[model samples]
Target: MGKLGKRTVAAREAFAGKENLTVEEAVSLIKASANAKFDETLEIAMNLGVDPRHADQMVRGVVGLPNGTGKDVRVAVFARGPKADEATAAGADVVGAEDLMEIVQGGKIDFDRCIATPDMMPVVGRLGKVLGPRNLMPNPKVGTVTMDVAEAVKAAKGGEVQFKVEKAGVIHAGIGKISFDDKKLVENVRAFVNAVSKARPSGSKGAYLKKISLSSTMGPGVSINVDNAVAE
Candidate 1:
């Protein structure tokens, strides 16, 4: 491995021996250690007890962070007629039907979130192979597949975050930015934890939330006490 940079070394030293911290403590530590040139995103990772291989064991949901994610979210909408105009007015970065699919198929997906009206699913469905792997497929469960194009567009550009457990039973997402106030970060963390807690599948056995960690884009991660994280 290459020599560790000064910032990374310092961050690791500060995080040494820290574990099972409260949400606030973890957020503070992560924020303090985020010294990258650009504003670093505050990320959260949760390890759950259930494997996602089984349909019933899957944990997937969306949460709107109390404090919007610091990054600008580019939204692409699949709609037509008035709904298309609504999406554009609400700030969608891209909007279309077959034309959008062709663009996506041509490997030109430039947006972060994708929204589709219910009637546009057929067109969106054809891009499943292209969008599903990236977790960009518009799903009704998360309200991305809906008739309310305007609300969906606004939410996407806002702070809405969608999370799905990986095969190894881990869910990861950016909760906010290190520059956010500690209180806002904590609130975002709690809101996310609560959403995941509520999304616990019936098939989950023993402990639903096995572990949780908070980290910045270029900083070392700190473990958070699962109970404290969910305690509101």
Candidate 2:
């Protein structure tokens, strides 16, 4: 088993559907059901029945199992000078500031994520038109901006992931499947919940966290209570 153990029969049974779900009830249920279960990744399926735009508010993001994303990630590192060399050495498909525009212009800047060194920020900024819609813009907040090429490459290669939220506050991300371990799934769920909570906009007043739900991509969302989840 990579990390999380197999998905328990309990989790499957507990998160049947949203026919009858209250925030607190869902949280207690998930917490209790996942005690001994282990799954590399949590497979959560959501039926928010909302627009993708609104659904964006619900889903936090998706993640790979600890056994690894299980497949290779197409990584492109934006760096120049020494950092470029470091990125290549660390296994990144290095792209330089000089060739940045042409690369973006060629319209083949297809990659799961993009990491740029501090020096390349200007260049990446110039190509905002090309990258904005793709959502591949470089950001340090997510650990994309850097001079440490090796660490960047390692993050890109090993733990590469993406994020987003749905309208119903039902963010769906992946953890290892039931075959991994329950702890892994629990840990992944915890990490995901923390991230989403922190992403709350300052303008979001009152009960920001109205509800929380987790499930597989094709599964159902088990709820998490947030009546007290809002920060004072």
Candidate 3:
């Protein structure tokens, strides 16, 4: 295809054969494909009739993607002491409980995520109405609720990265941006996979990491096969 023709072409290509593509091919495909797109995603279909549900359990931690999830994470860091000052200095959209409630009531601050020091947790409880239904309230399962102000602030400004086993038992997540180099995206994905695989609940049955896939912002998700995700 000519340059313009290829440019207009959909980037999606099926993962053919049992053989895995080289790193070069993988990265080139992700970067070149302009057809990438996203939908409100859900569980990964790993196999026929084997919809897995233990993905959330294998979560390592939710990280703030430095540039956001290609979108802004209206972070509300809850704190009211020395930690409060710390959070503000770190560039958090800092809020004390009183201010937090007012913001919520005004419907002005639609926070994408909430990070709080242990000191702020008690007060955060008061705003359950404002945060819970939206899934904006951070949970310990993903390490958003913490005593460390520095970590909280950093993670808050960071992207809201979550890991979970989709129905296919495949771990799915958005690692980084399409503008990011393939190696970096691969690295990010690799790191995430490692963390999640390590955190696999001991209670889980059978082998973990049924498969893997990587895609871009507006393109179809092309899979990264997992012959042995644990091995690497």
Considering every candidate listed, which one attains the maximal lDDT? 1
Compute each candidate's TM-score over C-alphas.
0.98, 0.63, 0.71
Compared with the true structure, the alpha-carbon lDDT of candidate 3 equals 0.56
Q: Residue 97: error of model 1 in Å?
A: 0.6
Residue 188 of candidate 2: its Cα lDDT?
51
Better of 1 and 2 by lDDT: 1
| Per-residue C-alpha lDDT of model 1 across residues 71-114, encoded as one tens digit per residue | 89999999999999999999999999999999999999999999
Candidate 2 ranges beyond 4 A from true positions:
1-71, 160-172, 226-232
Candidate 1 residue pairs in clash (backbone atoms < 3 Å): none
Per-candidate Cα lDDT values, in order, are 0.93, 0.57, 0.56
How well is each residue in 1-232 modelled by candidate 2, as lDDT tens digits?
5553345545566666643344334444554555542333344433333334542333333343344443356667778778888878888764667686677778877676788888778878887888877767877766778778688678667755666544443445454454444445455555545556666654444555554555443334565544322222
Name the top TM-score candidate: 1
The 10-residue segment with the lowest total lDDT in model 2: 223-232
lDDT of model 2 at position 189: 50
Residue-wise lDDT of candidate 3 within 51-112, one digit each (tens)? 44544344334544434444445567777778777777877765666677667667765566
